[model samples]
Target: MRREQPSTQEAADDRTDALRTEATSSIVGYRLRRAQLSVFQRFLTVFESLALRPVEYTVLVLIADNPGRKQTEIAEVLGVKRANFVPLVHGLEQRGLVERVPSDFDKRANALHLTQEGEAFLAHARQVHEDMEQELVARLGGEKARKTLIELLDRLT
Candidate 1:
């Protein structure tokens, strides 16, 4: 039987080729959407267990803390378009978690207020939101990780 032997440089060349292939595979464009969606999915898991979406949670908290805030102001703070937020506000109203009272300053505008029921719901939502924040930090690591990611996101936006 005859045994075939491979040269050392041939093996070295093979290794270099493999390295180049792997490097090419690694060099790709930003996977921002993939990473963003992953974060959102984790958020959804925590939010779904509660009875509110993240947006609703935010809205509830804002209303809870800033009673008599105008809907337009809330939309501004959230950086959401007023047109888009109208339906979200309506949904909260339908759930009886919030009420829209006519603004004393502007007859055409409405000021938002958390009713007694809304306050109760907001309290529970706050607890859930806090728990979710903890879990998010845990998954993403400590403050540094979150801050770094937030900075990167701000740049992208």
Candidate 2:
């Protein structure tokens, strides 16, 4: 007698189980990272529609709030390397969203400022982001969602 082939659904279910077993067998940290990526994937879907990277959005939001922030200070607040920010700053400059000016505190350092366009863009992008957050995480609502996510991320760090 010949053995019958497995059904498609059974094969797919077996594959999923195998993958899950493999995923769970690895280090706990790897599983944690995988879960974080899954959650943030949804977040990227929302933010990507704005046509701005999260780092770029953070820079614009920071500059809008802290007018005349020095490049060093901006890098420090965002925990990004000072040199790495040069390209992002240059891009913002090219887009007419930001301006670099002589620093009042230090002759060698340049201060950052958001141009009119940057401010307007930040405001709109932030509002859209908030709406998306609400839509995706209505269970946590506004403040609770942020607080919960922050708490969870803090524990990971």
Candidate 3:
């Protein structure tokens, strides 16, 4: 029998399989990042039809929960910088999903609120999110494991 060289695709596959990740695999930060990526990937798939990104969804939920919260206040809680936060809020406002009105407490600051459309959209999003969360919970081995995982993650933050 004659020896034969692997094809280009086969070579690439071999290289990929041979790559090592052991150095990072056991690290807490690396594991956390990988888990985050995996979860976010599933989240993106579930929310694809809604066309909402993770941060946008978070912002919407925060505003919905705190209807009269000032933009700066929400941004601070989310740890988003003012420069980046401005464009994010503007995009939401342009989509007619959010509104910025003068803050009752601070004349110069804008209070965030969801529009009627935003509320309707959020109601749908909430249902979708709940479904996704249930799937994640099941994957994590039920509600108790999910709670424990969340508690551990919360400690890091």
Candidate 4:
């Protein structure tokens, strides 16, 4: 008796199933990383037209919400290294989306703010982000489950 070999699609499906049952599946950090990757993919899809990276969007929001805050403070709050964050700020500044002014309280520090164009862009980005979040919450079984997951994740941190 001869046995038939699995087709290409069948082999791919088996590999996918294997990944689901992998040892890392039981680990919280691994699972969280996988979830983050999935969510970030969705974010990219939703934000494709905006042409902004995830960190860029967050930086815009932070500067908009806390105008006149020092650049270093914003970078610290975001857990981004000062060296790495300077390029991000510079790119936004070059795009005319953000500005850095000499801090009144501290002459050595540079305070951050969004330009008019940045504000308008952020308003649209916020709407897109909210819509994407709503889609994620709905997929996660609605507002209650979303809130519970957020609380659990908060506890983990």
Root-mean-square deviation of every model: 8.4, 4.6, 3.9, 4.1
- Give each model's clash number: 0, 0, 0, 0
TM-score of each predicted structure versus truth? 0.70, 0.74, 0.87, 0.87
What tens digits encode model 2's per-residue C-alpha lDDT throughout 1-157? 9999899998887784433576465877777687568657766787786777778878998988899979999999899997899888999999888999999999799999988888888889889777766765665576788788779869977
Residues 15-111 of candidate 1 have per-residue lDDT tens digits of 7443345544454333565566776787788778666777887898898889888999999999999888999999999989999999888988899
What value of lDDT does candidate 4 attain over all alpha carbons?
Answer: 0.94
The parts of candidate 4 lying over 4 Å away from their true place are 1-22
Which scores higher on TM-score, 1 or 4? 4
Query: Which of the numbered candidates is closest to the native, going by highest lDDT?
Result: 3
lDDT for model 2 comes to: 0.82
Candidate 4 or 2, higher lDDT: 4
Clashes of 3: 0
Q: Residue-wise lDDT of candidate 4 within 1-157, one digit each (tens)?
A: 9999999999887784434576778899999999999999989888999988899999999999999999999999999999999999999999899999999999999999999999999999999999999999999999999999999999998
Model 3: which ten-residue window has the lowest total lDDT?
Answer: 11-20
lDDT of 3 by residue, 29-73 (tens): 999999999999999999999999999999999999999999988
